[model samples]
Target: MCSLEKRGDVFILTITGDSDHRLNPELLDSITAAVAQVKSESTPSTALITTAQGKFFSNGYDQAWALSDPARPKIISKKLRLLVEDLISLPMPTIAAVNGHASAAGFILALSHDYLLMRRDRGYLYMSELDIGYPIPRWFVQLVRSKIGSPKIWRSVVMAAAKITAEMGVEWGIVDSAHNGIEATVEAAVKLGADLVGRKWGGEVYAANRRVVFADVLAVLGSDETVGDSGDADVASVMNHKL
Candidate 1:
């Protein structure tokens, strides 16, 4: 589902394939495992860049798979929540080389990074829940609130479900930079990662500061309360709406 490669002090975690890297159980587990590996093996100067080899960075949750089992939605939601926690607590700086479309959960995954570099040639950042009639999760709202500074932009994203392009993403402060293509975006991310690694910042110290900065987000993710009970009934409701 994914592979990790180290290039000097920068580690690249790539979701390999031309398909939309759907956030399913297997894929989520693979990503979480990769993050754990990065944590265990990282040095002070190490940095991470997550990218995908495809036309889609990730389309979103694997709804078809989610609908197959009543408990699956909550399972995937919990996994995503934990993965966000892992990314936030990661010692080294993180960047997302968004080479393709990032929708819903995929958007959240990209936003979990410390910085984002997107391709200008194609792809868009989109939050599809509103359009699809799904209630946006509370933790997701909090996370988006933390990342997006403008209330107007936040509304556009969560309420209007605007498909944000690379130029707009940079202009709106959602992404650090925009590049010409997928390879260019990844290159920019790697360069940015290298620059961050050059700072030689202590992993523990950086992670600690990040915790302090996003303490509210962390708390919400840890909380029991969500948009719903995240139970079978909740999953059923969600599926019904989709239908």
Candidate 2:
């Protein structure tokens, strides 16, 4: 489901296939392994760019698979949360080359990165839980809250289920920039990586700084004993709503 390649100090992780790139167990495992590979291979000068093939960056969790197995949902959720935490703490600078639609968990995945670049010609950054009849997870809300600074954008995304285009994403501080297509987005990410590498920051320090910046998210992710009292009421109600 993913491939890792190195071009000098920049590591490109691409999620392959024409599939929707859902976060099933197998795919999630593959992604976790890929991140581990990047961590092992990276140096102080190295950086990482995550992109995908075809029209989907990721469509979120594989609902059909989750429905088939009763326990799959919790497993997928925990794994995804851990994956985002891993990405946030990855030792090198990270950028998301959002090639296409990033919906639901996919949106959160992109937000987890240090920078986000999208294709202006196609695709959208959508929080699709409302439309899909799924509850948005509390950790995900923490993610949006940490990464995105605009309250208007937050309400629009979590409550209105806004389908944010590339340009709108940039305006809302959700994405760093918008490019013409997948190739352009990746190229820009590569260039950004190169520039950021020139800062000469140690990977460990960089990762630690990120942890501090997103300390709240880390706290929630590590909180296994906590229950209730998260995010907002209206959204949490819908998220915990039983069908």
Candidate 3:
């Protein structure tokens, strides 16, 4: 489901597939395991760059699988929250090379990174919950608010379900830079990662600073609040109303 490669101090994680990589338990577990591997092998100067192959970075949850089991939605939600928390507290700098569309949970995943680089030729950053008829998770809202600087852009993303292209993302300060294609975007991310690694900052110190910076987001992710209490209903509503 994913592969991790190391080039000097930079670790590149690729979600391997030609399809819309869905956030199902199996795939999520694979990603989390890959991250754990990165964490275990990390050095003080190590950096990470996450990207994916094909037309989608991720299309959010596996709706069919989620609908098949009554308890699956909460399972995925909790797993996603845990993954975000891990990313936030990772011991090295991280970047997302957005090679394709990132929607809903995928959007949150990308934003969890410390920096973002996107492909300009195609794909977009989209928040699909509004159009899909699901309530945005409270932790998701908090994360987006913390990362996205402009209220207008955040509203457009969450409320309008806007498909934000690379240029717009850079202009709005959500993306660090825009490259011409998937390869170029990943290359840029690697270059940026190398630059960060050259700083040779202490990994624990960097992680501690990130935790302080995103304390609110961490708090929300750590909470025991259920989806309904967070203004989100069951994933069945999405399955029934849309897919």
Candidate 4:
């Protein structure tokens, strides 16, 4: 479900296959393991970039799988939340090279990165929970607030479920830039990562700065206290009827 490769000081993580990369136990575990590998193999000066193959960067949770078992969705959601926290706290600079459509939790995953670069020829960044009738979890809301500076864009994405195109994403600060294709997007991200290497900051120092900037998000995610209703039950209900 995931692969990790290193070239010089850059680590490239890719979600294999053309399928909608869903956040299920198997895939989540694969990603977690890959992350662990990256941490072990990387140095303080190393950088990481995450991207995917096919038409979707990710479509978010595996709704069909969630519907298959009573407790599956909750487990997946918990793991996904942890994954986001891990990404946030990863020491080196990180970038999301979004090559295709990213929806729902997939969108959140992309936002977890420090920088985002998207393919302009196709795909969109969509926060699909509102349109799907899923209540936005408190931690998610906090993340949106911390990552997206424009309230207008945030409302458009979170409240209106806006399908933000690459150009619009750049305009709204949702992405650092837009490229003509996946190759270009990934290339740009690598270049940006290489440039950041000049800072020579240690991994812990990089992560510490990011944590402070996103303190609220980290607090809510790491507290082990329920910030609010996670909407896991609601998600299961929707999956049961719709998937």
Clashes of each: 0, 1, 0, 0
* Minimal lDDT window, size 10, model 3: 224-233
RMSD of each: 1.7, 4.1, 2.1, 2.4
Taking all chains together, the TM-score of candidate 4 against the true structure is 0.93
TM-score of 1: 0.96
**lDDT of predicted model 4:** 0.84
Go through the candidates in order and give each one's C-alpha lDDT: 0.89, 0.84, 0.88, 0.84
Lowest-lDDT window of 10 residues in candidate 1? 222-231
The alpha-carbon root-mean-square deviation between model 3 and the true structure, to one decimal in Å, is 2.1
Question: Candidate 4's residue-wise lDDT over 120-218, tens digit each?
Answer: 998999888777777667787898999888888888989999999999999998889999999999999989988888789899999889989998998
The TM-score that candidate 3 achieves is 0.95
**Candidate 3, lDDT over the whole model:** 0.88
Residue 104 shift from truth in candidate 3, angstroms: 0.4
User: Which of the predicted structures, 1 or 2, would earn the higher TM-score when compared with the native?
Assistant: 1
Q: With candidate 3 superimposed using the best TM-score fit, by how many Å does residue 143's alpha carbon deviate from the native? A: 0.5
- After superposing candidate 1, which stretches have Cα over 4 Å from the reference? 223-231, 240-243
In terms of TM-score, the best-performing candidate is 1
Rank order (by TM-score, best first): 1, 3, 4, 2
Clashing pairs in 2: 135-239
User: Candidate 3's residue-wise lDDT over 102-149, tens digit each?
Assistant: 988898899999999999998999888789777677888999999888
* Residue-by-residue lDDT tens digits, candidate 1, 56-76: 999988878888887777788
Instruction: Put down candidate 2 lDDT per residue, 1-243, tens digits, no spaces.
Output: 899998878999999999989888899889899999999888876799999999999988776776554445667777887898899889999999999999988888888899999999999999987887776667788988987778887999999999999999999988899999898999999999999988888999999999999999998885321123343343333334221
Q: What global local distance difference test value does model 2 have?
A: 0.84
